[model samples]
Target: MSSEEEGCFVNILSRNISNIVDALLHGPENAFDEARKEGLLEREDLDRITNKESNGDKIRACLDIIEGKGNEKRICEKCGQEAAKRCVTCGILCCDQHLKRHQQEGHNLMDPGVKIEKLRCTVHGDLFKFYCMDDWSLICPKCKDGQHKEHEVVPMGTAPNKLKVVLAEKHCRVLKSIESNESQLHEVQEEEGQTQNAGRGAEDLLEKRRKELCQIVNETVDLMKGQINKRKMEKLSLLGKQKEKLEQQNESLHQEKSSLQTALQEELDTASFLQGSKDLLKRLETMSDFKSVERTPLPVLDFSKEEKNLDGLITLNKNFLEKIEKGPVEHPEKVELDQNNLRRLYGRSPSLDPNSAHRQIKISGDLRTATLTRTGNQYPEHPDRFDVHPQVVSCDCFSSGRHYWEVDVRSSRWWKIGICLNSMGRKGGKSGLGANPESWCLSKLNNEFSAYHNKQRTSLSVPGDHERFGFFLDCEAGELTCFGDSRVLHVFRGNFMDPVKPAIGVWDYYCDSVHFVHLVKQTFITN
Candidate 1:
């Protein structure tokens, strides 16, 4: 070949090799290494072309151009001034002074190749415009034909719009959840307010009831004192009568003795003296006997018995206050609720009747609590009072509908509380609460407890610390349920008679007492 032709061919080879080196250096560092690993190129050939360690400067230069830093120092080759723009056709930059001349000479100023190179894949060195759905990754056409051949793929430009749609949906759902939680919180707060108001009102009512009970007890004490005084006066009058009779007898005897002494002083003949002596002896025999005056014992007051009665009255008043304070029985759903909840849900507050309390059962002035006394109380004789057993009935009775009540059994170690028909026997015999056909009760004997009905007893497991017992009766449904600490202890089903009242019984044991939990209906208004 001619020398000129040879020189032209060598220049062409040098330009092509320079272009290849530029492309390799601008791409990812491991692009050539990956090609060799995939058997697409020989390792020695890739190493010879890339010369990774020796091309650090070239790599840095390529990075600077990709990041636009190289543009700061770029200058026009012909004018030796700052370049205004780059040309795509010849891969050259020109200043404003030379740009017009270059443009008029038909040079294309756009750099389409630069944009295309930016979209290239690091692994395959090919344009990456496809997205893989299965792998959640970006892919080139070559990758789609290789590892991602069967994967779900979409155009990369549309992927962002799809992701935005999903994000918006998730945001809306989170907003709804927040609103729902806020609404629930508001309801809870309002309920809390209602509860507080109810509690305040209940406290006021309890205080009022307590005061009334105290007043009644004071009056009872005053009445008892008056009776004691009256009885003392009557006994003293009887003692006075006895003394008068004894004084009269002493006078008569003294007169008789004086006559006998005078007759002895007169000296007489033996016969006359004998006759007078015989008459005197006869008179002495016929006269009433002389005896020393006997002192009578004065009537003494039994202070201990009076004090015991007073104590019993005080205890009864305290128990009555406790019952008024108890309010009502709340539904089982609110196990952790306050007693005010019971008042709001249930309408009746039951108190023990002082008139119905047994003689041995000392009832408080409030008529809500009762205790067994060593000495029986002198309570009024009422048909509802148990003459044989120490028991009392509540003043309230339920004939229909649902009713609930609670008993504070903390003071009663051996006691009984339950429902009883109004016709249940109260005078005597085996007709007391839980001991006859008309009564049912949950009873505690010492530490052990049981349920009794129709004289039959059923064993029960009682918690050691349980101080309160809740009873719910659906008279219409013939169902009764008992609860302790929110746990259902027993459920009884029976064809109970109408007009049933609460009954309480205590054995003749010391310190055994019971309080009927009090409840008022005004507090429960939450719908």
Candidate 2:
């Protein structure tokens, strides 16, 4: 088409499209008037175009232009006539005359929704024909057999579908892992909050206990001061009475002396002077005949008693403070009961085994106590008997459930008492309780208390004077606790492999004695 003719056709086509859009937006009557006013078409041209015959013609022209056809001077590629259609696929203008011929020539019609691009392979200079699964690389037929012959190959379109499924599964797994981690993180955060709250509660409780103890100490001091003051006031009142009587006697003596001097200085006749002298002499004799007042010493207010009481109070306060400083004590989570009740419920009497006793140990006739003897017995040679150190094991053995026992090591300056596995070494040099792996024991040497296990000595801050020791064992949980004077001394935890028996031992060098309190089956009558 000529440039000038094409421009004019394009203008008319655009104007025709604008008129149709305006008619759709605003009614046809308004659009016709707007077209005339805007001079897109003159009044005469607008009237002609709006006529039935020409109206449809401009609309048809607009549709042809939309399809890249119907230029005023455009000629068909096949026929030298005005174009009526455009071959979308071939990008050529066509007339109705050759449309059937063009379709018969095997040119496909264009679909606006479908897009086709020619993608080339950089290496083979061919289209991407196959997908290699092993290398995840695009391959042509030539490269497929050369470098990727061993790889699993698929058609380009199918490869993407297969990868989508795999990618979906991997994405799902990643999301699942994230969810699991998030759940764990949430649990950890919750536990952290609980722990912090528990710590705060414990701090508050301790602070309250501290204040209570301080108040108690202050009250005790105030009471002692009151008592001291009371005694001081009583002593002072008694001393004041004695002082008053002494002062009255002193004043009486002075008044008597003044009367005698005044009579001697007065001028009088011999008879008068003699009478006065006699009177004065009688008064002097009466006044000089004074008996000494018995000197009563002031009562002394001794604070020694109060001081002793304060010392006891201070000692109690110190012990309480020490307990606070050591943090909370671990008590068995059981029903609240008195020691006797607890013993009645869980306690079992375990006597010293005759076979397990060392020669230097003497088992009591009742089989309830074992004492360190000065002389070794003529015991039969036994594998379990202690050859070097004095020791004895109980006859009763426990494998499961909770068990309780008590031992009295009051007389022992050096002793060990605890539970040991029945299979613990009996004759080896390292067979001593707590010296081998088979035993856990508490020991007291002189004033020092300590725990012993596997040849390790763990010092325990416990009193050595605790005469009675209680042992609680939870075999199922593999826990053992030692209580000294009813206070938890130490708790030992381990997976016990064999049945354990209560064992007590004393050093041969120190002939100290230890007694076991045997529990008897009796009905505890509660009143």
Candidate 3:
């Protein structure tokens, strides 16, 4: 063969090497031996191919050896052995071992030459030029026109690049999802920090209020001590003057008695003794006739009421502190109001009933202020009077409709302001404000505030001190709300079965007085 034909033959074998190796591994076992005898495969190459455990490994070994040898040879179609002669009639190659079989089949033979061809489609004998995406297979033009007509076919060169583009798009989507997750995590962390900051702000406000209340209490204590000391000194000075007058009268009496005794002991005549006795006896009689010094009662101070007040104050303070330490209550409801609107629409000024006042509770001339007094007023004994508790009720009563009122409570350290049924007990302890089912009240004992109803006391969250308190009663709605300086302190809900009257209680002497604020009519212009 010419050099050009030899080169063409080598190229065809290289392209069909996989098919050739596959056929050799499945066919005659002497193919490798034949290649080695032709000096195309070394002894080591034969050993490697023989040592492979699987047909696939042996095929790969044989292809490698064939690729390196570049031998110009043909494989017999019948038994996969190296071809030495060609069958002229069939245009197929045959080895010497298969030569007699072919001749007996009446086929003529010639020495083998370059007769290998390129791989072609088995069905149509056409070269493969396209890739079928549907079945991931290579197809020739004839195959594409036949069974692969409906498949997505593309040229062999662009199939891999299209798949790469799809993968890149999916990778971009994955990265976006990861970014979204990170953003959500950051939002959650920021919310947690904001919640912490809100808690800290509340804590700071509570601490500031606590300090203010403490200072108020300390100042009140100092004032009370000063007043008590002043009263004590005045009482002591009066008693001291009376004591000095009594001592002087006793000394004068002793001197007169000694003068009479000396006159009798000298053994003088009866005339002389009588003479001395006359003056001494006259002086003694004058002294005895002198009016006896009026005995002054000792100064006495009673603190039983104050002690009780302190006990109650201490209990209230303890409850308030415990509630504060536990943190703020959840869903705290605060009712906001326009002070002027409430005052103009529903404000009332109920006068205190002098007939219902306790003996120790003094009522001002205007009957709007109630004061705790040391001495009982000489009020006529009346059935409506509170015989046990130091409490008083308003003369005005309400059975329905809304009413609002304000009280000046700054003067009192311990006081109660509320409403009670007109028919409630007035002669026993149960008649006290908020002590029985007939009454409800908001009380302040020192720095602590609380709401009481039906003998149940609820600690309130109103911090510091408030000088004025407001009350709103909606009898038809069965609601009573208390406010400290316009801020809602507590609310009481109940069934108002009877007429209720405004009431006040002051049991401590230090609690000077509480006044009811009366609002007058006024007009205003709004823009």
Indicate which candidate wins on lDDT.
3
Count of residue pairs whose backbone atoms collide, per candidate? 13, 0, 0
Q: For residues 418-510, what per-residue lDDT tens digits would candidate 1 score against the true structure?
A: 888876778867866777778889988868888988889898997786898888777656867777787777777776535688888887577
Candidate 3 steric clashes: 0
lDDT of 1 at 91: 47
lDDT of 2 by residue, 1-527 (tens): 45444434433443365567456343445655654464443455444334435444645433444334233355455545665544433545566786677567643332221111222356765545566666656667788888888889876545545544543443344344435434444444444343333323322333344454566565444443443444445445544554555556555655554554454445542222332344444543443345435433332333443433333453455545343334222234663334564575467778889998888898889887887888788889888787776889987777645677888887888889998888787785788889988899999876899999889999999843788988878766688888887678888887653478899988745467887877652221100
**Model 2: CA > 4 A from native:** 1-338, 508-510, 521-527
Q: What TM-score does structure 2 among the candidates reach?
A: 0.36
What does the lDDT come to for candidate 2? 0.59
**Candidate 3 lDDT, tens digit per residue, 453-509?**
988999998877888888888766788888886777888998753578889998675
How high is each candidate's TM-score?
Answer: 0.35, 0.36, 0.36
Per the 3 Å backbone cut-off, how many clashing residue pairs does candidate 2 have?
A: 0
RMSD of 3: 44.9
